[model samples]
Target: MGDYEIALGASTFIKQAIDLRPDVGIVCGSGLGDIVDLVEDKQVLKYTDIPGFPVCTVSGHGGCFVFGRMGGKNVCVMKGRFHPYEGYSYREVARPIRVMKLLGVKTLIVTNVAGGVDLSFKIGDIMIIEDHVDFASMVGRNPLMGPNDERFGIRFPSMTGAYDKELRAVAHQCADEMGLGDVVRDGVYFYLAGPVYETPATSRILRGLGCGTVSMSTTAEVITARHLGLRVLGLSLVVDLAPVGQADDAVGPTHEEVLSVANSRSLVVAKLIEAVLRRITV
Candidate 1:
């Protein structure tokens, strides 16, 4: 079966189980899955239960979909998001986004925990993704690389505005209002294909490339969301500092450390998301 068929089948199965049509879709990454707890009157469906769905193998992901209301709008929250590092193709990693599009999601909010590649960044800071350096896509691993599915989108979709401008403006305003103006920043997200963290040398290279935040996920999903014409808003939390020029034996990031930071600061991210959702026209 093709990707479009798989997405359609999943959406069909989900629609049969829930009467609500989502206006917004949220893909929670890594330890950020707790954001779904904000969903009111939620109906959850495990990935294992959904047809053509890929299960999450990572530790931080919840592996379920939560459908409910938030900010006075019906929404679908992906409690777990797939990654290329998990042995999935770029297309498979982004399939849920297509499913969300089929389920009537007009807007997509994606969040991930990333290492801070820029020297100015500190752990626990939130970076509003103004743009991204899709390293994987640059080498031809884009989610839209396969045969065209015109039913879902144009054969040649433009990505200049992949991150919605209006949504980002509102996110900034919301952060300021929440007294987090100093904590929140806007920068470029560098998408690396990784199950392993970057080495000190690679981190230096990323810094040279002007990457503000770096991670393994988000780009493929954002590309898919943009292809399907969904307005996208990306939020990245800096959980660890990239080891730029540190000594070879210097301590580096661990999955456990990333989870620890993500778990601790997730509420702040949740609050910012709630504020953004409430304030946006949606």
Candidate 2:
């Protein structure tokens, strides 16, 4: 917890410096950092300047925090995220969310790049995560599997309503108003601890389990946010298609490919997020 104290101090310093009393928090993934450009009165803070902050090394991820207004609401946006694959502990990965709670973030909007396993899904499509199956949990690892901090939350928090229902409805309504209803789909997301993409056989098994998309992150953050009593919403950009069966010429999608897809689809995602910001209340 001492390590986390260093991070908390850093967050406090940033909060004071930016005069940021954020009502909402947004976590940007892959090429989705462009949304920060839309913020008004932006104050940017580099992760390195913050105490105990883990800097991002992945390409397309800008390691900075932005504080500003979007759609008439005050918000803080993470232009990049720290992942477990980056050699950070689960607690370290979830540290930012805990700090966000301390900084008064009541709602969290998390976004990520995912591979479409559901045949009905197309590349560049956006899927709203209705629920998640944590493959990490089945493998004896979990973000919450640590010393309980009573100051933050209870020992056992109910995850039955992790994703806020009202917020999701508002997102759908916003999409409908923007004529993007067809592009917005709702489905279960499956998390696999990875720096590597899944194999065809593994993809098939996940698809059979009703997973529409697969990603390496998001679930840990969701759990942390929910434990802190924040209303959570997740949106994923489908960057590649997970085809079933072996092919002699088949090549797996690269991180660059994922970023490319995210870049192209960012326009739609930005619009959806901005619209939701304007329409959602508390």
Candidate 3:
């Protein structure tokens, strides 16, 4: 618990200074930082100033920790995230989840911008992640690859029910009430170790493995949270569609594209998150 102690101490200090003890923690992806704008009476902390917090290097990621009221609930939100592609270890990437747990956050909501592997998906669509295909573990890299911290969780934690089904059902119901029933999708997300976008063959392989969407992050965080007995909810914004080897000159997605698509779909995502917050008893 030494590492966790150092990380948690720093997070707790900041959280206390802000006078915010939230029941919920949210990690916003790529271009989804705008949700912080909806936070009332917000307190913002820069990641660089937080001890043990990894600085975000990706564009469109606003690296800040925000605490405030959303949908009548106090929430702590990470406006950006650490990635393995930025040279951080899996444990380092999972540090924020540990910090959230220490800060008394029982529920975690994670979001990401991804490429649609399912033909039915379109850009600007939102998918509720029911399950994930962790290609990172398949290739021998995992956030839980090191010594297990007994204080944190066991050495072998079951991920069979990583996502909270009840929360997902509530989210869908909220979306339907908001007249977005047709746009909410539910499926498996494929996580790859990528600073680079997928090749045609990689996309095909992921599709064959039943991946609905593909992204470079999320799996590590989910694994860490589930291990710690936290309820989890995941959402993905479809930024681009994976080309099925149709065109060599296909215009692959860029960080800019991800931000644009996420920006366009931010309202719907924000509404769903807000509704979930309103419904949860804390």
Number of the predicted model whose lDDT against the real structure is largest: 1
lDDT of 2 by residue, 14-120 (tens): 87788868899999989998888778999999988888888898888899989999887899999999889989888788888988888889999999999999999
Q: How many clashes show up in model 3?
A: 0
lDDT string, candidate 3, 85-163, tens digits: 9999888889888888888889999999999999899888889999998867767587778677888898889998799
The alpha-carbon lDDT assigned to residue 37 of candidate 1 equals: 76
- lDDT of candidate 1 at residue 154, scale 0 to 100: 95
Better of 1 and 2 by TM-score: 1
Residues 208-265 of candidate 1: C-alpha lDDT, one tens digit per residue: 8888999989999998988899999999999999886566665689999999999999
- Candidate 3 achieves a global lDDT of 0.87
Candidate number of the best TM-score = 1
RMSD to native, candidate 2: 1.3
> Candidate 2, clashing residue pairs?
none
User: How well does candidate 3 score on lDDT at residue 32?
Assistant: 87
Query: Cα lDDT of all candidates, in order?
Result: 0.90, 0.87, 0.87
The superposed Cα distance between candidate 1 and the true structure at residue 280, in angstroms, equals 1.2
In model 3, the runs with Cα more than 4 Å from the true position are 247-249
Better of 1 and 2 by lDDT: 1
Provide TM-scores for the models. Answer: 0.98, 0.96, 0.96
Off by over 4 Å in 2: 1-4, 247-249
- How many steric clashes between backbone atoms does each model show? 0, 0, 0
